[model samples]
Target: MTADRITGITLSSVTLPLKAAISDAKVLTGRQRPMTEVAFLFAEIRTADGHEGLGFSYSKRAGGRAQFAHAEEVAPDLLGEDPSDIGRLWTKLVWAGASAGRSGASTQAVAAMDVALWDLKAKRARLPLAKLLGAHRDSVRCYDTTGGFLHEPLDRVLENAAASRAAGIGGIKIKVGHPSPAVDLARVRAVRESLGDEVPLMVDANQQWDRTAAQRMGRALEEFGLTWIEEPLDAYDAEGHAALARSLDTPIASGEMLTSVAEHHELIRLGAVDVIQPDAPRIGGITQFQRLATLAEHRNLTLAPHFAMEIHVHLAAAYPHEPWVEHFDWLHPLFDERLEIRDGRIHLSDRPGLGVTLSEQARAWTVARADLREGTGT
Candidate 1:
């Protein structure tokens, strides 16, 4: 008997809206904005003998419509290609448009297709994604940042940090960059006091400060002991980051906005950051992120990936030296199987293809291009 060859490819864009009420300001800048939503571009590949594979791409930003159009435009290149040769296909797709699509939105669109193909491959093998990626651990330690924005009062910030600690979270991350050094320092102090000296506390400024402001604020928080200071300066200021890292006791971490292995390599070589925080979608996909993880390992650095915990969980589980996965209690209700987080530890899933199933209700909320034309929904 001969093996079946891939015969065709199909693409669909799905959107899921948040059931929880989103606060106006949060909806604009917070993690769970009033319209906490996601748009996914799904790809399905069929084989000669009836076997099939499925893949998808998603983004939380408002420009997802453009991303969908880009994916649709690229679908033709993937049609009839061997779904089994995912690596080869990924390389070809990335190299095909090297001049025009090597990074940025183009690579992100390609990543959506690439990840979906990997999911289909895992499903066909009837194995978990971690196993497919070379599983090294069954579980990953997580740090909670569910208390986003840090707009809450000082007591409330400590309260949330204490709750995360009690939940068995290995650490806690709080938002900074409130345009107040004293206020940011006080918040970090309160959280540390509440969690005590042993529990790790991390802070993120969200790229809201310049070098002077970051250094002043970072130095003040150093006494409290932070796991790392994330994105203190602009995401693109590698030299500034290197300077800040040298000046501070807490490790400087950035790179969530970085888009390619080349960029990551430069940041690493520059000694710009001690920790690499790659967002799966932003970094082109698991393939590129995995390659970056290897580079981090070789350099004796930590891999603390950014959001999209569902995908990060699998990636963390596969890499032996992965430091910790950020846990933001968003995106759970949209998927059928939520990533299991127990007492700050994220347990890996045995389900195939990232173990996420899109609900019909969620899918129905998706804002298609036609929907935009009708102007009926967001």
Candidate 2:
């Protein structure tokens, strides 16, 4: 066997083009063009034994380069360290960035590294990431966020939901927080009317509203029986979320913007959200996500992982409780493999690691690349 130590790390930035601009309440409210570019930061951790593990993080519009730089900055700390020691490496990276990046971009960078480390561990064990993490289920229910953007026409939105349902997807979520509560409500109502009562429907406001608006809109939209209302207000408004949670029947799902497991604990301890939506890459990757998942299970909260479905599908499947994964096809070009979504549920593959590898399409999109060796750069 080769040295079990991590020898180097390679990084790349993939510029993904959206088929069309995608808008949500925040885009409409802020008057910014719906984001048309997705920046994907990829990390490939190489061990002395010639095995490599793949991990990635993404920015909706910017910061992909910054994340790659941060990952490079942390690479030295991982040199000669066992890839199986995921926890130690994660802590090391977190502490290294604590002064400058206790959260946000630094944490996002850590996510890419952490995921690569986990993939290494799973591959060494010759088991899939889910099984390595202790599989709670082979699949998880899924909901599509693709069709329900604020910019789509009502008919298109309805058709999107109908198409998703007809495909056997379990549920669909649309964007809310349009300028007018009535406008947002009308869209929700229209989807409800189209889908009828049986299918699950969710709405994401992208934190575009204030407490007053969230409360009012949450109340007004309550009639349609939403599975949950996502980010009705700002993500950090714990007290506001608690109050709204108490007032509404729909569960409040948040935490995607939060960058640490400790932050998730604060959100849950405060009764801030009924369903926790943590993004693995936004946090510190798989290790931190497992911590959050354990916390959610013990706290009796539902787990609904935020995007990067390719990575999250495995994590959600390993969650101790029933979990949901958001469906977004924007990253399809980045990976050679993807988890399957059938009959509205996502099934994880048994292949070792995260079950995905960078695709040639991803290679074509690479605007920058680097290979950092153990003793070459400091």
Candidate 3:
């Protein structure tokens, strides 16, 4: 029997509150909000066979309503379309939004749709997402980004790193680029001391520093043996990133804020970063992420996806190169199940599709929603 055609789509806006008010370098410097507000647009694609595939895309804050609206605006385009032809559907959506530019919030909204379509396709094939995408491994290594905020006291910073070490996490990333570079250096030193010299340590400046600041601070911080320094320069400043990369022995990792593989390719072509961190929710979902991952692999660059570890775990496992998934448990409340982490790596589930769905707790946080069916008009 032929697989069912697409029938309807549903979108919802969910708000995720941070466990605590966490601050990054940008936030501490008053460049960003002190509290993290996670706004996600959840999407569900229904088929004529009575199957539904779930997906979501998130914003740092306040954009979930718009994302949901955009998804609702585009949902009808998939009515009666083949869910398996995700690539073609993705192209159609992109072209439909071409007049409004091909990236940013619009593309992010498209990501919610693209992800759900992939989930539906994999479910129809009766294979887990990783296997459907071609599994390279059953698990991939993970690093904790939860403990690495700039607002915590130095002792607490060290304690966080120590806790992650105690939990068997492979590595930890700390926020950097404080007003006093000395403060940033001291925190890193303390964390490294607590975790010991052998444990992998990474730092994220969150694109707060200029080329000169990056050069000065990067040189000073080199004594501590870090795995990489992330986003020291702005995401679009490929030349500046290249210069900083050349100046420091520490690998510079970036691309989380970038919207497309084409943007990532520009960074890669400029030799800007050693590790590329693509956030699928921001980069138009798995289809675009796979393209970027392939490009990173071909260039011998490391793959360390930005966030949403639950999803990245499978994608990271499928990559030819060893990939690192950032662990941020703040959003864990949204999922029905917890990811299985063992020996510093996250194991992919064999369950069909993404193997996870919205939790009741997540439903409690829903603020707005939209439903689209075959007869609906944008």
Task: Tell me each candidate's TM-score.
Answer: 0.87, 0.96, 0.97
Model 2 residue 137 CA deviation (Å) reads 0.5
- Candidate 2 similarity to native, TM-score: 0.96
| Tens digit per residue, CA lDDT, model 2, 167-251 | 7689999998888778888888888988888889999999998999888888888889889999987888888998999989989
lDDT of 1 by residue, 1-378 (tens): 565555566556667564444332223344444445667665556666565555555666464776677665565566556677777877877776566567777787777777777777787788888899888888888998776455566777777777777777788888887645677777777777778888878888878788888888878888887889999987889999999988898999998878888888877988989988887777677778889988888887888888878778888888778578998766665567777777568888788767886666555655552211112111
Q: lDDT for model 3, on a 0 to 1 scale?
A: 0.86
Report the candidate with higher lDDT, 1 versus 3: 3
Write the residue-wise lDDT of candidate 3 on 1-378 in tens digits.
785788888888999888788788888778878776789999899988887899889988466777777777777888888888888988888887777567788888999888998888788889888899998999888899898788888878778877876777889999998899878888888888778898889999999999889999889889999999999988899999998888789999999999888899999998999999999988889888888888999899999998888678878888998889998878778988878777888888888988888999999999888777776642
- Clashing pairs counted in every model: 9, 3, 0
- Return the TM-score for candidate 1, rounded to 2 decimals: 0.87
Which portions of model 1 show Cα errors greater than 4 Å? Answer: 1-3, 7-10, 14-38, 44-56, 95-100, 369-378
Q: What RMSD value applies to candidate 2?
A: 1.5
Alpha carbon lDDT at 203, candidate 2? 90
Worst 10 residues of 1 by lDDT: 369-378
Off by over 4 Å in 2: 1-3
Alpha-carbon local distance difference test for all models: 0.74, 0.87, 0.86
Candidate 1 backbone collisions, by pair = 15-366, 22-34, 27-33, 27-34, 55-116, 167-343, 168-343, 169-343, 169-344
